[model samples]
Target: MKKSIIIAAIINCMAISSFAQEFGKHFADSTLRLDYIFGGKVSSDGKPECQVLLDGLVRTTGWSGRRNNLVSMPLAGNGRVTVRDKESGDTIYVTTFSTLFQEWLAMPESREVARSFENSFLVPMPRRLVTIDVELYDSNRKKVVEMSHNVNPSDILIVDRSNVNPNPHRYIHRSTHPERAIDVAILSEGYSVAEMDSFYKAAEIAVDAILSHEPFRSRADEFNFVAVGAPSSDSGVSVPRLGAWKSTAAGSNFSTFYSDRYLTTRNVKRVHDCLINVPYEHIIILANTTEYGGGGIYNFYTLTTAGHASFRPVVVHEFGHSFGGLA
Candidate 1:
């Protein structure tokens, strides 16, 4: 019995050592951003199929993901991204995330009309050439669509976003080490340049609300916060139900999906574009409006109205959807 227990312990240690070695061998200290279009269309035979197309690649500095779970996922999500060494064809990294595209798939509009959504996600940059496999799953956890693309680390076409943006920002809460921090970027949506100070104040309230929560409260030191002063042309967001429109930084708008209270934006590319040069694993958009509407998507983005009376609690609840990946 004693010999069996000792042998099991040795095997576990060997497995952990091998896992760490794989992460160091195949990945670098940088990050690779993979942009893709996730869409769906019905065929002549009445079968719906989801298609994936490579949009672009971005090279960014300082990967902020877990190094221990190199090839395993803690949860099974609607979508998965897997990176493998090209030569060995061995998976070096894997992660699961939910997408807004998956939510749109169930809408009635998708049945009759073909639609595509912009999706951009990141993985640890490979030291050498790698093959990226993207998989989409159904509600039953069955794989529905799969696509593989090869990536060369030395590709010149890859956009480099390591340089910081000229826009002014302030840290609400900062961890000593970024690589070990859950970095959240708070972006201004409808606040103009003159109202940036107000945006910063709202951002602080958001950081405090998140850190005051149960699990996050205990792990406050493991998180970092930054407020990006993305000025808008107007001072408030667009509310089509009231025939009010404003040119926001992230183009956020209310009346999403024809519901007056469902605030969301399909301009995902613009939202990400505004995040250039920001080191963030999560995003929160603060709209300069007093409306009682907001939206959140798992692993995508969270948005809340900063001028609302319940802004503090709403922001925290929306963040639970974005950061915690809660439904």
Candidate 2:
């Protein structure tokens, strides 16, 4: 979870590439769009999130509930801006405030660089999806486009072709039944599989208990599992100063390993492409070591070497992220 130090620090919000287009160009066309549902303005009564967010815009944009002449009003907590055609009910696109805005928000210390227009994602919304249908008009109050979803804030993962403006948008894929795959690579740093049985059982029980919850019921099919080897030399090894993570006496070095793992894990999408043996979406690495240390990521997975079976459960639990994106 403490994988990418940079991603962990950034402020969370959503917006697309540009101001004038449909949402089809951002991701694979086979996907659908789901927006963040802003609370209060919309209800979660099984309603799509995009509607809640867009509906809020119509209500607040100084339009006074009027669809035409929809003036652009940057909401107090607004992170993204949207524009729609009054007649056609289409959304133009999404963009970010200059890098200065990110810095100004952080003040004395901000890590974001000022991005230029060229680096922005600007495109059109897609052909089909949920339709809250709030259209925007031009200066003449002519209906230009309309948007189907303006959502509430609860984050979910789903493909959105509604806005092709891509700057790395997030999506939530909810499923009524959960499915997952796990690959555990068992390596022995200094111990054997038999010695780590206790830890293995502990990990398995923990994973089983964790999956007992209901939230993941809808989206678990993407799960996967795999395993590899960990030689004795790596049993209690700790990575110190090599990356953003630090080593601790009580598994501190393991933290550094995670940062480095993240450096690679972050690019896991490519890993699958390179290794014909690997799956593109998710994977679980189980090291058969004794010392305590392991971690899991949203799209990647890992576990330290435990006993003969100590890491089996660890691999399953961590796979939740690489396969389910639940974390």
C-alpha lDDT of all candidate models, in order: 0.80, 0.29
TM-scores for every predicted model: 0.88, 0.28
| lDDT for each residue of candidate 2 in 49-119, tens digit (9 for 90 to 100) | 12223211111001001111223322111133354443455653332221112112222211222211111
lDDT of 1 by residue, 1-327 (tens): 343343233223212322355667888878888999999965555455799899999887776666665777545678899998899888888877788778777666767888888888878888899999999987788887999999998999998877756367789999765555667899999998899999999999989987787666765666789999988999999999889999888888898767777677777777777877677778899999999989887668899899999998999888876665555
Best by TM-score: 1
Clashes of 2: 98
- Quality of model 2 by C-alpha lDDT: 0.29
Best lDDT among the predictions, by candidate number: 1
How many times do residue backbones clash in model 1?
Answer: 0
Q: Model 2: how large is the Cα RMSD against the reference? A: 17.5
Q: What is the lDDT of residue 197 in candidate 2?
A: 45
